[model samples]
Target: MADYQETLDLSSYAALGDSFTEGLNDPGPDGQFAGWADRLAGMLAARRPDSDFRYANLAVRGRLLDQIVAEQVPQVRRIAPDLVTLCAGGNDILRPGSDPDDIAARFEAAVVELREHVDTLLICTGFDTRGVPVFGMLRGKIATYNAHLRAIADRNGCRVADLWSLRAVHDRRAWSEDRLHLSPEGHQRVALLAARALGLAVDDPEAPWPYQPTPSPADLRRENIQWAREFLLPWVGRRLRGESSGDHIEAKRPDLLPL
Candidate 1:
């Protein structure tokens, strides 16, 4: 492996990929999305307060795996940070007629390149979407892609942030109103998972959710209708028109500045 400035004692971290890493739906006090990357950065920084730890998140919403490789991978290579996290392919898998094998192949290629530069390259698996609405239909594909991601991790000696095994996120509370992105608690849990993957002692990512009464059948019908109108339809329209929510969106944090 090439010389990384810090190995165990990480002084900098970077994140790459799409909306999840960009911290979608997990709003901060200022209303900015302070997704898992930011939360993990906090954990990493807290681990070593003596040194100046820098962090950057070069993730944009609605980006495909190829887009992530093209746009963010080079920046990661250039910066050569100590620790790097990559979570991609969700958007690609969401597309109609998407091939999990192909996405995994490209994802593997990205992982191969990324592992060479950083001291520790952490890659994430796709979530088990069985608990999510609409997306649940693609669970097979996502699971297939996740299997590939795990294989790639083993082959490349990269760490895995195994989102598929996280039972907490399987609950409805972990998802946002749109049922697409994670909620604040969900992002925090993901951050904890990442920290644990990095060998940090952290909270249980699988902590049980608070109690809630199951909705009636009529309530489910009403909620489904509301969801279709408010979120699903707009998403479908964007897909049909070849328009992305991230058409003009830029990475929230492009530079590897001090944390």
Candidate 2:
């Protein structure tokens, strides 16, 4: 529970980072990547229905922490939105031989730069990938990163949307078919977390997953093989060729506009 009793006077918002912030996999009203940020923006607009509320999302898929700091942090200074939500560094840590501490330093620098400009800053922690297939191995690294992030938030007076402890997203159904990005429901769950972190009340509980029998060992092994062939192999191929899914993609909402 957020245990938040009051909300700030939120008017404008800006979201920065990688695919998670960009709203990939979760289709929006216009049928674009409308992930947690878009959903949270909707809630913010709903709070001030007749008033002017604007939001911008500058996140792109496959963006590294450095890319986010270099590209998106400057926009916060220029736009000077009332609220800013940044969720970066996942891509960097997923890369071979990347260090969580190094990524945290860059993230903190961006946070410091942003704190001066925005009224509220919400920083998301790395998700706990335990129980997932390939991502399970990354649990320890993500935990270390989350610790760093929590400390950063405390030091900088930023709010944290702690994804690691969110039980709703740990369910298998919360993930997309590829099991890399979140499914639409997962995105919705995160948006609720974001709103709660902002001291906004969220009364509804997340929907429970449908009942399913536990998978046998063979079933799991078979699924892993299929996933590796269809998703992992292609991702590895992209890495080898130094390409990104967002190489040609641009921000869905590049400028702050009325919701």
Candidate 3:
């Protein structure tokens, strides 16, 4: 199998996955979504200015690989996309009470379905959230999921974007308020990973990731406390007061904000 760039034309591609590919919170200029897929599409568009092709992002928040297999795969088959990028299985692996075996199976199914249609397919692995509490199990599950992805892609002659390695080695301060999701900067990093894997380039490689929101520990605490005093306390005040406040803290709590 050839590399992503060598196999498909960047101008005509499609993307499929969940929130990470949709840019749920990181909306770009003119209200364009700012997920890695969108960033990559924009980059490719600029790289081939005369080539007017379309990129379809069929991703939703909280969707697992099975959903992609059931929903997005059908549409992609109809579109007959020149290239397709998939970044699923994250929500499935991270969800509470999730079954790793099921997640891997679903991922395999998605890859199989995608391969039937697109000539060049790309699979992105998940980040290493080992530092997050109760996620030790998830780390192993992600490895298993990636293994399945690789096996399926290889068998079908598709490309794999090593996003897991990139996130593992790069600075993670670029993440967003919900440590689970990426900020605009983080999305940009992801975009670069995809671009390089596909052998494309953003107009200005140095241009920022659009929106960079840095929330420190202090910011989180302030937001949490403010939320407690206003919206939360009003509805569940007495009940929350009875519970230990520490339990409400996010998994990866930033240091206490300075008053």
Residue 252 deviation, candidate 1, in Å? 1.0
lDDT of 3 by residue, 193-228 (tens): 777777653332234434557789898679667755
Q: After superposition, how far is residue 199 of candidate 3 from its true place, in Å?
A: 2.7
Can you write out model 1's per-residue Cα lDDT over 27-122, one digit (the tens) per residue?
Answer: 876567999999999988987868588999999999999999999999987887998999999999999999999999999999888877877999
lDDT against the true structure, each candidate: 0.88, 0.88, 0.65
Candidate 2 lDDT by residue in tens digits, 228-249:
9999999999999999998988
With candidate 3 superimposed using the best TM-score fit, by how many Å does residue 31's alpha carbon deviate from the native? 2.2
Question: Which portions of model 2 show Cα errors greater than 4 Å?
Answer: 1-3, 204-207
Give stretches of model 3 more than 4 Å off. 1-7, 133-137, 167-170, 201-259
Residue 111's lDDT in candidate 1: 87
Please give the lDDT score at residue 152 for candidate 3: 71
In angstroms, give how far residue 3 of model 1 lies from its true place: 29
